[model samples]
Target: MKKFSFLAAPLLLISSLAGAQEGVPSPAPTPAPASQKEEAQTQLVVLETAMGNITLALETERAPVTAANFLRYADEDRFDGTVFYRAMSVDWGEQPNGLLQGGTQNDPKRILDPIAHEPTSETGLSHTKGAISMARMEPGTATGDFSIMLGDQTGLDANPDGETEDVRAGYAVFGHVVDGMDVVRAIFASPTDPYKGEGWMKGQMLADPVEIIDVRRIDSPEGDEAEPAPKETNSAEAP
Candidate 1:
């Protein structure tokens, strides 16, 4: 048998493989799941409105108190027939921080007890586009009312360099719109009743509030074998 130069042959094979892969990029790795528990515990809630269906991914893990409060109303079907009463619209399409507000009507019978305030400082979520935050009169008065951002509003987040806690404190952002932003924008652009709101909220009230037909907690559309996902029925009813 001829001399088999094992070392030289292996070196040649390695060089050939390296040459073949010289310009090729490696495949990207898949992102790791947030957590095993988050996968099963996080929840979705679909709000059926006259315009369309708006799905929200409530961050129960981050803001337990506030998220649970919203769930209470949703689970009890109290959001049904509620209207998108206010849309703080501007003439320009660049509503970088404009707001749209609505929630269960001020019916004492349907309202639940106000929960303790969960500031954005504690939650670590910012007021970015698609963000949904609880609306309150003072610090701890948030209940049924909520607001959705049409554009980024990081200013609404807790300011780290403020003199007082109130100055740094911000609204609790428990969830965000996962789908149907077109519907949210349409509601934002709906004509306003110039004479509806009182002081600062004047002219922000929707001329015709878009009615919410149903609001219910839904399983992940990603599909969990334990439960069936609710079919998203987009409401096409004319306003």
Candidate 2:
């Protein structure tokens, strides 16, 4: 296993899996009723980037607050003209694994108020391949920045018994890429600037950032307009 470390902003910190502390696992919870076991409501959105379109299905029912926040930005065109400014490549385990970061980059004019931290433990989400998550300096501070994971990154999941805040709270995962992962993979493989970012973010900044032309909700697979189910509670804090 390889270990990675991240500093708070520029973006959220990613802890090294090798250094993760071992603790007693918590007992499993009772299963939800069959009605509640139905798939959560989701919203299909396409991120039209300079490279290509990456489609995402936001889990609004599971991670309501975070999903709604993202929807608001897309609806208002706050993500237009933004760039995928960072790419963190993971060198261990499988090939072609890491994450790409982008968004409003906290542009005061484009970003809205910060939302609450929605740990994966709470939202039942994980930083799996093609997951779309938020980027923030601390819990409850994520605004417009987000990351699209390129591989299974459950290492970023919340550890309730973790030794530190970042580990304990983990990062929120509100959605996953439903299509166009090829576009995401291509962006993750883009060139990076050796001296562009500060501290841990250094060498991870994209040399020629991919521009995010815009983001918008798409019709469901069934060819009907899909409305996000109202979920006021539940998830972020990603790279």
TM-score per candidate, chains pooled: 0.72, 0.80
Candidate 1 per-residue lDDT, tens place, 1-239, comes to 00000121111000110111111111212232465225434568888899988888888888888988887777666678788887754333355336777785455655666779887667766667898887754457676778788875554555545444433555577889988888899888899888986644567678899998988777754322223233323232211
For candidate 2, write residues 128-182 as lDDT tens digits. 7888888765578788888888777766677776666776777789999988889
Model 1 ranges with Cα > 4 A deviation:
1-41, 90-97, 163-165, 221-239
Error of 1 at 141 (Å): 1.3
Q: Lowest lDDT 10-mer window, candidate 1?
A: 9-18
The TM-score, computed over Cα atoms with residue i paired to residue i, of candidate 2 is: 0.80
Q: What lDDT, from 0 to 1, does candidate 2 have?
A: 0.73
Query: Which prediction has the highest TM-score against the true structure?
Result: 2
